[model samples]
Target: MKHFGGNDRDDDVRLKLVETLYNQPTSLMMAVLTGAMGGITAAIATQNPVITAVGVALALTGIVRFVLYYRMHRNALDHDARKLERIFEAGAYAFAGLCGLLAALTIYLHPPGAIQVLTVSLSLVYGVGISARNAARPLIATGQLLLVCLPIAIAGLLAQDIVYAILSALLVLVFAAVVSVTLNLFRILRDQITAAEVSARMADNMRRLARTDVVTGLLNRAGLNHDLVELLMALPEERMLAMFWLDLDKFKEVNDTLGHPVGDRVLAEVAARLRAQAPDKAAVARFGGDEFIVVAEVGDRFESERLARAIAEDISRSIRIDQRRIDIATSMGVALLPNDGHDIDTLMQSADLALYHAKVGGRNQVCFFDTAMTRDLVRRKEIEVELRSAIQRDELSIFFQPIVDLETGRIRSFEALVRWFHPEKGELRPDEFIPVAEETGAIITLGNWITAQAAKACAQWPEDVTLAVNLSPMQLRAPGAALGILTALRDAGLAPHRLELEVTESLFLDDSADTVRFIDELSAEGVRFALDDFGTGYSSLHYVNKYPFKKIKVDRSFVSGPNAGRKSDAIIRAVAGMGSTLDMDIVAEGLETIEQVQAVKAAGCTLGQGYYFSRAVPDYLAAMLLAQERERDEKARRA
Candidate 1:
């Protein structure tokens, strides 16, 4: 079977052929009047009863043929394509036969003077009509010319008189002239038709390109806009339209880690699946990067929900690209027309809010638009504004929680945590505002401030006491990250060895090469790096060995609670044992209870931090705690 793409050449030929048939009526009517006049003139010039009677009969015959030709042309529109072509072919043959008959009669009757001249003139004029009218269908034009002129020329060649011989040569010349002119005219017509087809094709291609997403082969934002408007305009009184806004979860992670070519394949597969899953009447488009929109007509909310669910199931299926199988999930936001919104822009905004809620509610599910979700966005906006001003107004402050040495009961290090002292809302933890900061790109500014403050505080601490600061994934992946950290150390007059940068496994998933390389640079410069919140993300034995890190912090999730506590103990033991062989120090974080501290110590943890030591406090209080510890150590040494 042939591919589904259209063929333009065939269409051009067909259009021109039909046009040739359509043009015949106007030219055919002219031929009738001229032929009748020529017959009358021949009769008058001859002045013979037999000649007049024959001329009158021929005129009447011409009139009959004229009526037939006119009827065929008029009825062409009512006929099917094949039948119309057949009608045009019959008309051409009939006209050509009439011309030949007139020529033969003129020659055989030997009409006198002006009558013979008029008969010959009729044949020449009809030759022009054949060439003009049938140029588009050159075969028809050629056959008609042969019928009109060839018979007359052959008959003239059989005559004995010199004048008759000259007339025959003239007739032959007329045939050649018609043939040559019609052939060239046909070529021009074919070229013009081809040009027109090309022009039309180019216009269609331009529109397709403008409205298509090149990567996914789906409709782009412009196409979506056009389709949405069309959907709105054509809406029925009872029917409702639903819009599904689907965004791929962790798509950037795939692109950043796997390269754009792999990312492009993923996007294409996504579009193909979405299109395949969508209903025939649905209009699917690529609304944003790794985001798709489906606007489908539905009878009710149940139908809309079913469609969204099916789309989600289809999109979530695994895709294999470049011999690597990747599983990606889509979070969909649905909004129904006339219920959620009436216009395209309003529906899109409503859908976006729903999508936001879906992401917030934990991805890999669908959410419908509701008025209540507006408050969540409003709070987000408020947080965004306050976060931007957090550092400038000195609303941001760092608190230090000590990482205690398990063997010596000494403060080994302090992890600096940022607390937003909101004048109205009191103290806010990283959980409440960190995501917003990262989303708003305010984390970089805030992180930089925290790093500087942490470095300055660690500088005042005892030489053995290092400070660990959790580095946001945003800060780690951004440009100038290494320089920013080094600048912070220099400005704070702190040694690189006195500060440890704590990074989560999330950073590795984002851009492993860049993140690993940046950490390598800092580690080479005598700065320490540790995997923070270890086992909470995509942690692996391979990753632990590949990266140059001095310490691993066991995430709190495995360290506390019921049966989780036993599992945490087992996990802690396994990690500490593995860390020992790798020459890595293990720090058990979020140790709240004395039992938690004892459990980590029994598990061979070298360091521990949580409420067991002290909750994170201001720099002055943390300094005093360290001072008290240092003074106690000195007195014990003196004793």
Candidate 2:
């Protein structure tokens, strides 16, 4: 018989085959009953003492085989598969030999009689049974077949009668045919088992892939949910689980300054650091881009807090990738089970809310969940919802703040600022609702309305005085923003040159091609641009040289703050000198007193905008101011 190649999988299949033989004992029972019946019947027919003794011996042997098989089955785990198979093979051979001896004796003692026919028939029955029953182990089946049938065939040939000689030849052919059949059955069984094992292995691999994060090799969101549920179910009363939600601070800057490939490397390194720093037996998972979650059991709130801070400190360390040192920090939010939340959804929500507070408070720190944070979040959400409908409800209005020419003391332009009149909340400033608008995508609609309104108001003023409207970075990146601005200008009958769009330095952080194209296209159309809050962000000079900026608005921090000093004066003078060389207007923002105004004018600023000149006023008041200025200029011209 052919055997399988002896690999581990093949060995497993072989063991299963051997186990099948022992598991089904119906064939073994039948073999024993047949042997006893045949032995008793032959003994009565022969009436010989030796034949009677052989009959008793055959019955005893069958009983012994049954008892041994039962014992092996009972203690199967105590024996190796190969050892058990060897013992089975030995018992089978012994039983078959006894049957063969009985058949041979009967044929040799009788002369073509009923007694001879009965014993030989029993031997043939046993041979057929072995072939079918022991097909899983074909070698054992073949050996049993030959041992039980060959002796009968020889005894028939020794009778020397032509009929008996023909029977012997037929028995030899049957043995060959049965052996061939058993071998084919073994091959078929083995192939089926091998295919099942392969399929099972493939399914397991697919399951693992589904749960794993491809880049970081950590559990993904779905896997985290699964483990969290199991942990909650098995949680002990004395133990509490802490869920630490971590977000990499300013991670988008890494991807924007570098590329996604380098960003991915940074994320992978962060994952490694988190895994190494996490408490033992903690479940770490990647919750999505630049976010991760760690869950572990701790004794008390202090331990949970300590662990969260430790993880944050470890992750704050600098990471080196591809010969570049990248300094990164993490903000973590901790939520405890049975204290902060009782279920997965509530715990996750609490952790996320805490994370928001951590980022707001400052990065590289840990924040625990509290009820106050939830109230603040709910209030912010309400403000966002109300701000969406403020414009349609006539609750939104634009205010104008004058930007004065320092040398002439004449208003050069008025920057349009938005204000909201909430019916229930009395009145709300831009800072209260604008951030919510930006987050909820309401800024796009609000910004467009502001543009149209400001343009119309500016058209009513003297053409020499332009309108300055601040643009959100989100508004600039929005598609068709340039077209929308042009549409507003065309509708309001305002010339493009009389509209100045002020953008912050943060706009250039990502180096977006679309933003550059937007600026370039608008500049070509004669619209003006100013770099607002210039010194507060990254690398202002690079952007000043790259874009066609008509003005540079020095951030208020450098003009009038408690920290303002000689260093501030130096920075202002340097920027003013640069603006002069570039032929761009330099505006000093946040001027509150005459001294501050004079200091900025002496520092080389061409323009100043702040409360010292005028606070933001409504359109009617601004138009009146512009009309009065025009009257004054007319008198001066006449003089």
Candidate 3:
């Protein structure tokens, strides 16, 4: 087994043995008292001058041994442990040798009497004490035991009596047994220490792994919480901490388009960049997925803002992996301590709210939390709750705006727009609540209802006219979404060819093989798709060519804005030309005047839809308009 000191087993065992030997001051103190008392008693009992001098020498050796033990104990950590152990060994040997010499002198000078018995008994007692107390160093304990016992046994043997011979032989046997027992005790103590050290090291490693992120090797959410609590508690009163909540925009698109392995590499690179850009005192952590947090102490709001922006810029740079360049951006939200919040939970919530606003305002920017954002969050929550029951209350309705043919001036289709007539707020447009529904997963149900309603209403109109309904990205990507739309058309008795589904370019950002298969299935059933708000999103041209779109609608910004000069007209003409070449219809939206209508017609648009023709109306009004168109067509045919 490995040792915690990173040394061989024998070396570690030796170090531990030395440490154990010096730790017991009580044993050393007892040895000192025994030596002094023995010497005093021997000098008093034996009236020989040589015996008295030997006794004085023994007492001095005991004093020296006690002094060494005191120094080792006091400087145990600061001094070389091995050197201290050697010094201790020298002192023990000197004391044991002096005790033996004093006993030998007593046995020779005096006859079989009280003084001789007392000195020999004290020497044997010293042998027993070293065996137990110094067992950690077996060699040292054995040396001391033999030194104290052998002299008395030899002196007794030299007395030339059978009683002394028997006593000397018994002393040899006792010392042998003590040595064997001390060696066994040393082995057991060594094994126990080794096991304890291994267990402690393993536990420390497990704790470290538990708090680390496997993908990025950064502190995980649990680690962040653990460290953040300590940091907050120890925060200086003169300082303020800023919590930056960062989210990578379009990171899901990278995961969906490329694979998760590539996404992981990207995340790792992002983590490295964050570490490099963060302040020296900042604590960076990964909150799983594409979310990361950085907490740093700052002087004021301006410093925090500067750091957030700098980090965002660094993370937004293009990352190259596997010979492919992947570009991504990050949005950050900042919340300050003592102002935005005083605790971790409150600060995190405030920063997250600011992050939501950053994403909404447009990604790749930094936003700070304020009381107004909290109020807006409450309002959004209210909308989410009310919208859940809006359909059950029958408060939702569809309005149809006619799509007219530029050449024939005839209604070709009516695009269905959903409106919510809130009981207290009256009419609310799609923009006000559609985003909330999409976020809360209410769009799936809302889109299905609109599709079925629009299809049913179209079934009663002229056969040549088609119905167009918008599709949310969420609905299109939902499981079995194609089957649901087909079921709606069949139940309404509306032909699939008369249903046109309008989708935005944003739908393709997170496009997957399953979504493509679903679109193909619906297309096979004769449901046509139109690219809505084209040229307003990334990779519009790529999506237009990739998917089987039957129509492409020019974004309203290019139709009648003050900026719509030669450049806008050229773009419209170019799109119109491409659509004609591809055998697809081109529609120009948001025309509000005759001049705009004329401009699109001249630009070769096939269909037009805007307030210039008619605003979105109820089903009854739409039906009346269709009936009037049929009458005019009959009159023109007769002429």
Candidate 4:
């Protein structure tokens, strides 16, 4: 048994064996060699049977211990052969114990002779055996050398023979020094080998990271560019090629509604789907932020379009993330090579232009680039530039539409809608420039201006009248936007209760938590919120209940015609009923006819706003209507 760390039972057995052979190498070696010399000398002198017997036993013991240690050292070197290591460990301790016991018995029998040489030799052999089993190579080598010299020194000491002891000690010292030097050299070489392996592993890891996208695990742009360049070079000059730029229809909505963590998981699933269904010849890359570019090789331009359509449909199929099934629809734009251009830049430009057209034409569709698409692209670019200048010049106006109370038949409040007064294009509706403004991040500035202007107008209205301002989804994310409205109201000397900010269900998309928090913050400042265009989005009722909304404006699509859609009518009735129960205000929009107005009023909607009262009028006309309403109410009260 051998002790490791600090176990007593195993240590006692090992210590007892080591104690028996302490410094016994010299005695053992000399006992073997000098005993042979003694027997030879006795053959020359008087022959003695006892002298021959002692000589043979000493020589045999030294040879046996040497053979045992050598075999154990070889077994320790074979790492794959673990059974050999265990066997060697057992055999080594057994040999050491037997050698120690033999030495003790020999020393007891031959007390007057040079018996200490046998005892010291057994101790040294036991030390080497124990050291080898524990993987102490340097110690094992040192112990082996000590064992060889201990026998020679002990023999000379007992005989008082100085010349024999000196020669035996010299021989042992040379053998031990050689073994120690060899073991040290081997260890240095082993360390160098281990370091080389680690360096190779690190290099492989770095290379893998370079080629893979961190978010989607798809090939990154760099990897895609390299692969595409190679493919282009290999293809025939006449071979048709195209790049399909795929953008998720409403990826921003996904990121906003569910958390971004869920968004990332959806992107990962999307990457997997693309890889599984992508054309064999096509190479896919994430490009950046919910956009993917696939380079495909085809036989003709039509084939490329067909392939792009197929890819779009494949992506539109359902995907499950975190146990929730999500429908992923993509709008893809294909730009054909040779027809578009051979260069990646030209191909990308055309594809992007087509992608814009797809979004404009209504999302979840595929479009191919042509000369006609260029006009729309150039026009859009012109609009984008003009929009930036328009913001700086303040070429915008607010059109206030009245939200009339059904019971009073009087305007209770007005919703402020934005109108872009383009220098050359005249008055432009939000549909013309809203998307462009949002893309340019100009909506933040435009939205703040609208909030401030509406709040300022609130002070001029009658004490009982309130001013309602529409909020874009972009404005909700603007820092201090809610505070800006409160500040404007305070500066204008208007009551907070008389100011309402209208936000659509789209505001809750992707960023519901932030929207909820912002609503809570502003609601604390006594500003009220109205959910605009309700029932047109997913779970608007649930959000209305969760949020602090003062009013729910039922979507106009429900009130578009008399009994137009049964589901829409039912939805309007349910929302009005629920709002009444929750003590919330319900407004019906798009009431163009008396029947639609009467239907909504019968449905229990207290507020109605649309062309029935009037379209959004100029400020002067609106003020006249307000004055008229007040005069009529005063006359009725007197009567």
Candidate 5:
């Protein structure tokens, strides 16, 4: 997994090839002897310095043969045997051909009697030797040998002009063969170079795939570790690296709602955005799933915080998937190296703790590692671990929160919420354990419990009142979830119209077409759809116009105070007006103050729910509250 600094083995192979090119011997030893005789013959006839120099050069170059042969025994016996054998054979054949030509040229120059006989005899000997050495292709070797020896032999016999005949034939044959073989050698070398290049490219590609993630095309875990370790060691001592561990908030909702294919695409889109937004000094990696880690260089904790916030905000804005716009958010944990902790394990733990803190602080936020966060993370981890057994022990329960009818100031429906009665922690709110349940895939079982419990409570309600149950996006994605609801309603003897399901916009994100289709199917069967946290999401007016929803609940974010931000007020009014025009119900949630209630009522909303009505209570207490409202309404009518 570590980055390679130098590859000596591959380099050594190339160096060895260079050495082989400069030092290989020939099999044509007789040709070398013939070359020496030609030098002496040329010395007598062509006293011209150039001719004598060429003859002498051929004789002296024969020393290259002795040097190469001396080293041949030391080479590896098995390694590249054919390649090395071919090199030696090629050199030997070329040497024999050169010697035959020099002999012919020396005779052609017309040397004296002794020189003439010696030159003609040497030409014949070289020609015969070349033919013998090239036994595998004697026709080519014999033809070249005759081309050099025939004219020299004829002239030597006819006029005894050995130097003239030998020089003419040898010069012609040697130059011609040299040009032809040189061209062939050039082509062979080019082919070998091209093949080596192809091999190098293939190796590079294999290394790339091994160290990269196919989905994000970023460094995989192994690559990340190598890169981080290298960066840590190379960084300036005065500066430090900051790591941000980011987990996409509620990413499972996207998967459960839209399926894994859509989820995969979303993750890719997120990775692209991260790379684009990441600082020049940062490295981003998709650790796995919807979790990513970014390592950056910063001047101080504040600078790190600034970068984390920017990243979180940019990612949270919006992502369109399947032609539907999704509101995406990420919770990030920031850990500074050498400050939070130096070692990878400690740094990772602190960053993870910070991430857990961000999630607990209400996702879509950034939290830096601190002593307090570690304690909270440990406690939260313990709680998450314990939640696994809560369902098995029958410790999970549904608590009812009153949904009031605004016009009559009476409780019309009891909305079911979840709570965990831990053996050690006493009572735990949904916020504390709902996330844990969702993470562990325990929401499916917990959701069934909520649905069944709410249906049973509805059975105990007055025939006019309805029971509202919250459904997780994950639960809604479950196979046969709608059927499960139907079964619970039938078993509890609750009317279909009297059972209302409060689902967040995330519900639309799953099996969206099928989910929307299922919603339509169930609505046709008298089930009502309440869009919860309306203003907090990408509330497409098209969705309201398209789906058969009965209610649009303004999120608490928009209706929390009398002096709510203009944006919040505008969104609430727009939603309420849109719902009214569509003949859908509008419920304003989190109306703790009378002024907030009045604001919602003025906006044409008909229902409200918050601490003003009552915090979530036991189903029996919720029923009593509903009954008390009825009595109070009766008393008001008498007054």
Candidate 6:
């Protein structure tokens, strides 16, 4: 077996193999010193004028070659491949051989007294230089040793001098032993180099994997940011960058209904389409999930908008996967550099904001970010940034709205609404920043904080009046959703039966199995479940049948607006009847007017919550309101 069993054919390994052999600087330096020494030794050992003349000429030739090689090395680029290494090795070994031949001739032509000692000394010194400098590459050391010491050993053997023959035999043995030892050294160096190469390849693979999106073979968010920075650095002064943030509309519904396999195929198809349509200079990156970014340098704002529109038009085409036809549409947002903001982060944010507007205002189109949108986004970001700190600093508080039992005119429960006091912006309402918090993933932290705080508040409330808190879809999707509530209830000493966790019908459009399982697990713990904003989502009845909810809160939209087919009161009555059949209580939302209140009560609605009872009140005010209502009831009983 080949002892060194790696790919010796690798150019990097091959180049490393010859490093010591063609060390130009070392080779030239040694050649100059050895050439001068050889000439001087020849002159001193032999008075023969012919040998002296030839030695000087040999020294001059070696100096000239050294000068030439030095200039060549100086002119070469740092990355110049070692293509001439073998040729340079040949020249170096040939010059060393010539110097050795000159010295060998001197030994042959020497005058009698002390000359033999001087000549042998010259050969031994050269052999030492070879082993010392070139031993790292065994072949280089072997070549230099044979050239410098072999000729002298052969000359001594031919002289038939007993002492010279004994020394010559010893020199030959020493040369052979060094070649073997340094060859082992070369093998070690080669093995180390091969191991380094393997490590380098592994690092490169890891870097590529980090930058790539596994699903679509596109640059992920990190890679996109890196490429964007590189592109900006390479861009011309007059050119501006445009970022197009593209989101596949209704993608969540596709994942929910058709399944992730089809959703994945759709995402892949979208990437393929974008790759085909993107400009040569544009970079297309998958920003995870159904989002993608296409960035390019634009000559003007019109070109930026034009590119965005073209991309939207192409991606909106119908796609078919496994015989399931899907009509897909994309919403795109465009932001121009310098005009939007010069940095990659600001530009991407602007593009994302514009994409949001396009999606919300009837998707399948492109929207360029206007100045107004920038201001609006800036405000939203400010709120989102502060909202993170607000939750941590205990600046968020829960305000409860009374859900009244309309028949008895008594408050059955109080629903908790999170309110934030922005130190600079005054009291900010939930509608302004709740969605932002959800989008930024701050909701997870805020949700936990809300649950903990609300649990504590429930501990302080009357036992019969349960504390109801709205849950974001993110909260319910967590695996520990039920566990978190159970833990909080246990910590606060509140009975699970009195705590109502409210969720909207939109939860039904999510991963249905997980959602139902979450609700079931929590309901099993005696926590009451309410389907809030019931008719605002598709398939409310489907979700109602799937989960055991104790109450359904009618969405104010259908209750407040006149029914397209009949009076709004009729829809309310129908929902109330359905709730009755399910043994669930029905509460009408957005009952601001006394007439709307009377209408829902007359329609058989058992519970109601809206401005008609009171806008959501702070915890202290809610306590007072409940107290007043109790006192009034007692006075009525006495009367």
How many Å off is the CA of 240 in candidate 6?
2.6
**Residues 181-233 of candidate 6: C-alpha lDDT, one tens digit per residue:** 76766677777877887888899899889999998998998889788889999
| Candidate no. 3 TM-score | 0.62
Off by over 4 Å in 1: 1-11, 40-83, 154-160, 202-211, 222-237, 317-325, 373-437, 440-480, 483-639
**lDDT, candidate 4, 557-619, per-residue tens:** 789955567777778889899989989889999999999888899888989999989999766
Query: TM-score for every candidate vs. truth?
Result: 0.58, 0.63, 0.62, 0.45, 0.43, 0.71
Instruction: Tell me the tens digit of each residue's lDDT in model 1 across 1-639.
Output: 121111325744555555566765666667767767776776787776765765676577667766766675666556565565566667667667666666766676676646666776677677767676777666677777777777677667666668778877886777778778877777777777788877888999999899999898889999988887888788788999899999899898899889989999999999998889887768899987888999988999999988888989988888988789899999889998888887777888788878877877888889999888867585675687799988888998999998899999999898899999899988787887898888857899889999999999889988988989888888987888999999999999999988898888877775668887788889888898898888776887777877888999988877764446666688889999999998999998778888888888999899998887899999999999998998998999999
Q: Relative to the true structure, how large is the alpha-carbon lDDT of every model?
A: 0.81, 0.87, 0.86, 0.69, 0.72, 0.77
Q: Alpha carbon lDDT of residue 92, candidate 2? A: 88
If both were scored by lDDT, which would come out higher, candidate 1 or candidate 5? Answer: 1
**What's the lDDT of the predicted structure labeled candidate 6?**
0.77
RMSD, model 2, all Cα superposed? 11.7
The candidate with the higher TM-score, 4 or 5, is 4
Best by TM-score: 6
Residue 53 CA displacement from its true place in model 6, Å: 4.7
Report the poorest 10 consecutive residues by lDDT, candidate 6: 1-10
lDDT of each residue in 473-575, candidate 2, tens digit only = 8888777999999999999999999999999888888998999889988999999999998888585578888899999999999888778989999999999
Pitting candidate 2 against candidate 6, the one with the higher TM-score is 6
Off by over 4 Å in 5: 1-199, 321-323, 343-346, 371-639
lDDT of 1: 0.81
Taking every candidate in turn, the Cα RMSD to the unseen true structure, in Å, is 13.4, 11.7, 12.2, 18.3, 16.8, 8.3
Question: Which sequence of candidate numbers ranks them by lDDT, best first?
Answer: 2, 3, 1, 6, 5, 4
Clashes of each: 0, 0, 0, 17, 24, 0
Which pairs, if any, clash in model 3?
none
